[model samples]
Target: MARTGWLRWGSLGVAVLVLVVFLVAQRQSVDVSYGQSPSSSGTVEEGSAGELSDATVPSVEEMSALVKASPVVRLPGSTAYWDEARVNAVIGDAHILVAPPGLDEAERGRVRDVEEAGIRVIGTEVTGGAYQATADTLPDWRAQFATGDVTNLLVTLAAGIAKRPTPPDVDGFRWREPTAAEVEPVAADLRASGLHVAAGATLAKVPDSAKTAFPDGALYVALPRQPYGEPVPNFGPALVKLFPDKPIVVLYGEWIEYHGPREADFASVAAASFYGQAADRISRYAYPQGNVLHAYLNRVTDVRYAGLFDRPLPYVPLDPLRVALPALPWLFAACAAVFLALSATSLRRKAFTTTGTPARLAGLTALAIEVSGLSHDPSVVRGIAKLTAASEALAENLPDQHVRGLLDGASRDLDEVARALGRNDYLSDVYLRGRVA
Candidate 1:
């Protein structure tokens, strides 16, 4: 039964492994085809085949040269452009492209002029007006906020960000619990300081409708107070749930009255760790943004520890790998639960009444030999001794009182047979007269 159960589990594992391998192979085998186009520059235009010419497709080295020569590379516009670029296996520096938003004749002429002037034009959905307003332009955060202290604080934050050296790899800035007054200026300051604030998504505490009003590249700005009357402890996890894809950097101020000044407090660190572990990273700051903007940027870039002694460590960033890592614990737990359930099912099917059958048969055979006057033989005596030990072991496993008593009696009878053989005249009738019946 034990061997069969092991084989069953092993087969299940093998089947699952084969299925996963087969699925991966099927995905890899499918070919992805690119549409043909007629454009000389090799940028795939919006929609259908016959848009971009294959012969003019830019090589990786060529694209790199074009980007290096141009002051600003416009972001590529259509899905067709990406498909064509991917077909060439071009892996170069990311380019920024600008395009006329409309398909009007005048707009096409403008694009042609830009292309003809040695500024290689890339296809894009963004119009000239939108690009001028948002992309690379410094935002006015103070205007978005109310005319009060919150606006003043945000303006100061923006100024501080502008003065400080930009943090590495920061696509944009995200504010936790931002009020309406704080979002725009912070984004603007970061943008003016050479940080790419336009790439980030805006998640603010303002009305759901107003969240879209912030300039491109701004993260969330938190409300000053907690929302929905939730406890302070719940803020971090809830915030993380809202933006599960992006790497979270929770910048908490210690001087902020609600949090107090306990940098290494267990409850505080634990609560923060829960948030960090849920998303990407978290940090606790002892000072305000005014004096420590540089330090703040440093901490934001390298969020290894939460406090001075590294009281709480930042969690793994919510990358593809991090997203998969969490499922491991759950997978192990599910396997354990299945194992337990299987064991329980096996136990339920096992019949206790059949447990001592072998011992009973061996004991009866020994008894018959002894009664036939073979007790005097050395082989019969040894057989009786082995059968006695077997009966004793089987007695322990039989749960029924009568079965246990029967096994015990058989063991005794086997022992008596061996003992009686020692005395030449003594014939043991105990096996025939006792619990064997």
Candidate 2:
């Protein structure tokens, strides 16, 4: 071969190799920064948070009135066993705590007992705490639904948070920061989806821009404010100064959670989560030790009666765009180019006809259909495929209105359904978080 020809072929091979590598690695994946396990459930066997006496379960009108009167709605039930004091504590607090998986049929029956008595059975769910949530963890409300009970509609979707700048002061804990700028985008998606988001960080430390960009959410403050004595989290609206109208919840109080000396020790920590803090709501992470449940409830009840958070806790809900306008840059560019090309060429001369085999189009369409529903919402995938088919078919000389409608309407319908079902942006959570890093 001539030297020039050899050089050109070699260069072409390198380019091809690079393109192949990029293509092979393009599927997005999210990298999770696992939180600390500084630790580390049995129920009352009956499943009640034990806070309520058998007769104390509220009635429907009272449940309604109770929630209306209080800022916090306690989920009553038990996941682990509690001591006498702890059990008493739960009843006095009037808020209930329970674990879903640990509930025996009888325990579940008691929760139903409460519900039958007119008290709202389901309440807030948490990810990992003293009882950390795994990928498989689900709230009891989900169980209620499975059994064909459709009373409460709210379920808490908690994500593991990264306390910025490594080796969080919480001791024996660590979370990896994203290499990708995943926080802003993920946070944006959460806000758009209308789900409540709480990330770990000190309000004073988080960047101003980060605070502004956060779609509506709260600060899961856990650092700097070492839990040596007791946490008297700054009360009132002072949190708004740092978070700018955002609520501040103590993920860790007095000291970080998940680090108690004994599993039961979390009872005090759980108690502290409510005591001497500014937050209207607190997560009692005392793990496995259901004994702590009552103490946790007592604090919640105490704070409520104490008239704290008399004013509404700072709340700023996130506002996402009503309709997505194609987030991919390549798609935008392709559309823009097509528009300009059609505008100039059609006006000045005959429209250019696209050339391709109908068989090739048919094959691609069949292939897309086979895989369209494999991942995300099948409706969305089918709709997107339809639109893509409609667009490509036009280019290849076959325009189908059916495909167009499928794309426009079916895709949108799927999106709405996914939202209604509380389906999260799984791809974004994983893909964006990892790829961006």
Candidate 3:
């Protein structure tokens, strides 16, 4: 019996060791430092051709020259979309791409003229009732869309997307999420079109199909927030989780209702790091009016982020930090509970414990909480105050006048920290800094 028991335990230990070794080897097999390469370096899947690999990217140097070409091709979203100067400028400066709200006859003609000039024109579709919303518009759209000048037709989904069926049977349809009731109809249409059916998803609201529906499809992401707004934290992993097997194309619609101050444009660029990894193609809107708008164009198209444009304009990505933020309170709670428990037990009834371990622990933990952007935490402030008291109690043993005075001064600073952070909302350390004096 003793021999059998020893053998059983030994077998279990060997199995556990093997499992750990396998896990480590698997992790080391792939490049895990994804933050360094925001765009994927071409990863292929079993049944599907990836989205990034699907789009033909020209040389980075050529793209850089195109972006630097000035005055760059500029097109307005509204009435002035086809200004003569803008039309003349795009001849060699840029490609003509169809996009958004609606493409008109003259604007389409201008796009065609640019195409005839050897410029590659991309066709875009705005979906969700807009496609088939009117009977007459559909036929006209189909006729214009047939021109080989347009290589791809992207369908931008609206919030009201579910209410409408996606248009079927276009040669170059960038199909995204459609209503559940219309999925079969949409899929049936795509099956007959002999076109690649790719998918488009947004950040906050990803459709179920992105994960399970389109294993072989290319991935297109509509950035969750406006260019100026911060995206969900850890947006990269979130997107990969949703569509693991597809190539990703990021879209930044830097449209402003009323373009604001310089600071707002600056805000748009702050979210660009999210695109650093896994993005195959990035596209932006063609809005020409405000400096802020131009700032957005410059932020993406400039040499710094070269080769990311998906045409019309350049694209930026969303951040991943969004999902990580909500979990921070839990982190604070865990840290607080552990340190507070340790402090209570170790410092019970003592003015100061030996080595001042409990007080130091509390102070460090509280400081960390504040650094994590939770400075307004009332419990953390109270904990710091209690620790300060403990430190003062330790000072009682110091008979040296200078040492005691310094200790007293430190205690005063602790008191001020406690007072400032007693509220609910976060107040910047800068605002509270000199006010204490």
Candidate 4:
């Protein structure tokens, strides 16, 4: 029992040790690099004058000597080689440089230099108006715009601009009245589609149309007229109030302009007014130069209000010790059970036995009787036969003659039984007497 208990405990301990090892092996740590920029282009310090030499700044004579250059320079998004010198050269001869609106500070500086050279910098803010304009004329324009194919529309408009004999007016620009033909088709389409069509002569003209277009609907889209100005002081907020129930989509033909001290404030006001009122419902479409504007709009639109936000922490792998400790009690209990079972089985086997003295003695005496009857070799049957013959001789040597004779007959009968028993024929010879004869 003690041995079995020790063996059981030893097995259980080994099993638990193996389990702990397995669990430890299963533990793993995951490395996560958060907040690191994935760009392989490397980081550029802010406000670095990239690839532009100071000597490249040309004098008036140097600038005047250069031939008349095209106002429109095709500046690819990243690899434009745009320096102050090349920008000045472009500005030197052209009356107006028409590019996309919403230039960064560097670009604005470049534009300012160009404007200082008596050249006008016309930044086109292509808005949803262009989409609507094209949609009115070309039915596929809306679908194309929805799929972000404004490049196709820009190409078409650029082609149109290239073919124009005279440049479009920039200063003191008035909204070009849409022809009756243009307005009529759009109005008819809106009515047919059960959608309201609102026209704005300028940014100020949007409120009335917005109220009439969307009274209780979730969304209100206002398509502004051509040549929209930069977002100014109270204009964006006041326009937002006009559509209290719905978000407004503002579309401008020209890039919105901002200048002086009010630029940041106006941008903030514009963003806040649009976002606070409509949240994500407001979207602006500006022509050529609205990429920055679109980026800003996307930023503001992502703002979400928090009430009771809860999120599960990311799954961190548990330590091997921590995981194994919780299961230790169960493992110990299993080991204990195994030990107990082994101990109980050993104890039961030790307590009971069928090969004790009484059973063995009874079996041996029966074998002697059976051996006396055996006809096999003397050497094989000699021991049991001698014992039986000695018993018979002892009975014959007794002092009482009758008792001695009876004892001798009993011995003879016993010899016959022993002989039968010796021959492995116990069933034929051995019997317990019920009555003495």
Q: Tell me, by TM-score, which candidate is best.
A: 4
Model 2 whole-model lDDT (C-alpha atoms): 0.32
Best by lDDT: 4
Tell me the lDDT of candidate 4: 0.33
Question: What is the TM-score of each predicted model, taking all chains together?
Answer: 0.17, 0.20, 0.21, 0.23
lDDT of each: 0.32, 0.32, 0.33, 0.33
Per-prediction count of colliding residue pairs? 26, 23, 19, 23
Off by over 4 Å in 4: 1-217, 225-236, 239-437
lDDT of 3 by residue, 310-415 (tens): 2233343763444444544455444444444443443444525443433343344344344325343343434444444544454465444543344344344444
Model 1 regions more than 4 Å off? 1-71, 74-258, 265-437
Name the runs in model 3 displaced over 4 angstroms: 1-140, 147-396, 399-437
lDDT for 16 in candidate 2 is: 38
Please provide, for model 4 over 43-89, each residue's C-alpha lDDT reduced to its tens digit, 9 standing for 90 to 100: 33333312121212233343333313544433222111112332342
lDDT assessment of candidate 3? 0.33
lDDT-best of 3 and 4: 4
Residue 433 lDDT in model 1?
43
